[model samples]
Target: MADLAMPEIALLGTSADPPTLGHQALLEGLLQHFGQVATWASDNPMKRHGAALDQRCELLKTLVESIADPRLQLAQDLSSPFAIATLERAKQRWPDRRLCFVVGSDLARQIPSWKDAQRLLEQCVLVIVSREGWPLEQADLQILRRIGASPRMLPMSVPGTASSQVRRRQTTEQLPKCLLPLVLKHNLYGFNTTNP
Candidate 1:
């Protein structure tokens, strides 16, 4: 069992193909609630990424740096497609701290189908942040609770800008300014120098 007295650390893993204003807002919001927030860019097994894992990591790193908060860190080492594996790695890194796995409302419904999900839920507290379009349903929360996950809803409002929308639009308007140079340099997400 995790030590309840220990400091709570928020662990966020996302497919940050091109970290957007929304991602930055989410991290900033997390900082206001949690003592420490560790985030990383990872490959989602269910989705096809527009950028490579390394590139995505670089993009996320840039965003984390832009936040300029000591408590917020880009933990690329914890990147893993499987939540269980990421949770295990986090346990190894922060042996004494309580880990809270952070997810968006869009992903909250898919937790049960993940590999070793029960074990993952049992190990860490699940924190769900509501997205603009994806609303969390009572049925979903009940399902998560039934499977041993003590899910908590984060009251932060994140911008609706999504990576898929950015990719489809192929514009830099939705991306953070800090990430624009990297996106332009690599030409990721079909964004070019001419794109405003």
Candidate 2:
């Protein structure tokens, strides 16, 4: 089929450290722009907590399963330190197509801190979802412009929910319904089924 030739993908750098509303909002925004969305669950030596590589991968599979669109899929990698590798792999897998890397504004704020950020930006279009209380800085925009990345901002209701906050809430606060299944399945955020 002609559909198979050009596969548009959006790579989400999710720790799945218990995927939260922030991650969901980012993905939903990307889903609107691309025909295909491939979420990347990475194994970063630097990350301290969240779902293990296999658990995060499985969670991504579960999340993708409910999507009705045939274009959406999940990809797993245990070696890629930067999300850019996902972009590179996507390009290699679908050389003739358009691909974009999806990220949250929170991460966008930290782009300069990432490994090989310039090279990453050069390879893919960036679809950055805006988060409340956090916006991209002039320096970030300058870097993005320098790399020729058409950075975009998408709006989503991702207020005070962050993985660390979620984790702390699990200790003393009730687990929100939307995050319950994922927390239980991944045993993340210190969420105990018996209590939370």
Candidate 3:
């Protein structure tokens, strides 16, 4: 008898300058839907400057260690500005497996305006995680359907965590327990080394 096909990989792209508990929660939730998750900090045009890519990767590594889940893999191999570019690269790395691109509802709304938007949609299955405040509209849903896009909306249970808010607070106690030391060690988001 023929063996079953390999499980698809969920490529979750983000600018996790400081990986939060909410982000961790989202990953845990994703495991229920997707086979496995490959998370990485890709370049989002909106937030250009913060803690550098290496720093972000290091923080993610720390969180992964704390979670101790083998399914969650950190993939910072591609730093492209276009979603399609990243999707293609993942294909190259894991040629035989399928790929699922996960994004927030806010990002989903903006995808229609991205570079090679239609091509991006075609590259992989799009999983839009619906968070509080940034809800998807009916028209946005209709556009996705009209464009021949492969998409699914998953409700994410996050604790109102935003990198912007973490930056403003500049307090490790305000962030995830696993992430606190990394932020302090790197002096991220304007954390004062001498003071902290």
What ordering of candidates by TM-score runs from best to worst? 1, 3, 2
For 61-85, candidate 2 gives per-residue lDDT tens digits of 6655654367666666422767666
Q: For residue 38, what is the lDDT in candidate 3?
A: 87
Clash pairs (backbone) in predicted model 2: none
lDDT for residue 187 in candidate 2, whole number 0-100: 61
Candidate 3 Cα outliers beyond 4 Å, as residue runs: 1-6, 193-196
Candidate 1: worst-modelled 10 consecutive residues by lDDT: 187-196
Q: lDDT by residue for model 1 over 1-196, one digit each (tens)?
A: 5978999999999999778898999999999999999999999999999999999999999899988999999999999989999999999999988999999999989999999999999999999999898989999999999999989898897888899888998877788999988888988887777764
RMSD of 1: 0.9
Give the TM-score of each candidate: 0.98, 0.78, 0.89
Candidate 3: tens digits of C-alpha lDDT, residues 94-179: 87777778887776678888888787777677778876677778888789877767677775555557777777776565466877
Highest TM-score against the true fold, candidate: 1
Error of 2 at 164 (Å): 1.4
The backbone clash count of each candidate, in order, is 0, 0, 0
